[model samples]
Target: MENILEKLGIELNAETRLTGDSKFSFNCHSALSCFNTCCSNLDIVLTPYDILRMKNRLGLTSAEFISEYTEPVIQKESKLPFLKLRLGQEGKCRFVAAEGCTVYGDRPAACRYYPLGFGIYKNEEAGDDFYFLIKEEHCKGFGEQREWTVGEWRKNQGIDEYDDKNRVWMEVILNKKLYSPELEPDEKSLKMFFMASYDLDAFREFVFESRFLDVFDIEEERLEIIRSDDSELMLFAHQWLLFALFKKPTMNLKES
Candidate 1:
């Protein structure tokens, strides 16, 4: 399922967007003719956490993976900059193989959520999320014996792990949308955002090898963790973004 929600309940369309309790039948494997068909000619946006998992899984630096496998794009409506998986010949995904995904264990979030679409609607509180079917013509997974509620399918697909890791990055995007007059991201700011959000190695350099240490009063304990841990560094990067992008004072600068 495609989850834009951080917590429970969501996707769209009264007719197709399903509730957490809504049930559906579907399954996919090499036994079916449409086994790997859904992996091609698609627009898959890479979330920050997706990048982290994938680059490390392939033993590649963020810069190398992005340079070789992805292209930068800006959404027309949201104007939020993100990376898209660059399709190879015939509009096929780079990771698709004769059997299945080469990076199946580290597949991107959108890939894991096929045949299910998810969305969100913000109210005053935590907000409501929903799900829907993405029934492609080539897909025959719908005819299989598997029956599941939206929540069940999400659980079976192991999306909670992805959602948990990506929660903070999603917040940054949502916060961007709430800007008073809207934030038209510039070249420099966009580069900074990408570095913080997806380029962990680059961000590491920025933190330890640049004036970042001089400008921010980071605790040594936290520094020690971020230095060796990519996950911790990614979180620390998100904290820096909140301050740099919105001046939220998340990081206290050294007294000048």
Candidate 2:
């Protein structure tokens, strides 16, 4: 862990010691050393799955959540949309509660991967693999007297579902280096990509209000699948985004 963290030029602290393959156990109890310590000083990136679950958990419309809790910006190098959570006063998360996370069941990938982070850097010469562990200044839970492996920790945290939904987004981010310089995106393409990828409610509105649905030759069955499954919706959403950005030809139909 130290070697990788060093390569990334990040610092290490008591809160973030490497226990690679070490058995560690954690649970919510009154005497826990760093009660709610994990809630402080967080910078979490939200995925589409997280947004859908959290909005449902809070009874929020997707558009409402995007406007209130998110800050969307483009990755300067790739011109890609990225979403980060907006912090409340004192730099704490808006969802932090007196006991623990109010949205514990619907927390973002970053929260689910606490004490561990993930990275995937794929390049022409060499590609990086996925990995996770504790980070600097994260010591609040290390003193726990229980034991479990990294794999078990993830299982207990309920991360597999988020991972499944995030797979396509991960592919887009990791494969950025694969795009040729000759295909640099213009302003319009960049704008569409940013909105389609980050701003969920806005995208939904566009789908409903614009001629977008009419422009795509989507089958009735596929539309039904997307309407029923958020993940399928995301997959189709990306297709439209790609078409918008690259001017790729798509099947044509009538507006619903």
- Write down the TM-score of every candidate: 0.88, 0.78
| Candidate 1 Cα outliers beyond 4 Å, as residue runs | 1-12, 122-127, 176-182
Summarize candidate 2's per-residue lDDT along 15-116 as a digit string, tens digits: 443333545555445466666767766667778778878887888877788889998766555766677888888888888877878898888988887766
User: RMSD for each model, in Å, please?
Assistant: 4.2, 4.7
lDDT by residue for model 1 over 37-73, one digit each (tens)? 8888888899888898889999999899889889989
List per-prediction Cα lDDT, in the order shown: 0.82, 0.67
Q: List the residue pairs that clash in candidate 1.
A: 9-129, 10-129, 10-130, 10-131, 11-119, 11-130, 11-131, 18-131
Deviation in angstroms for 31 in model 2? 2.6
lDDT of 2: 0.67
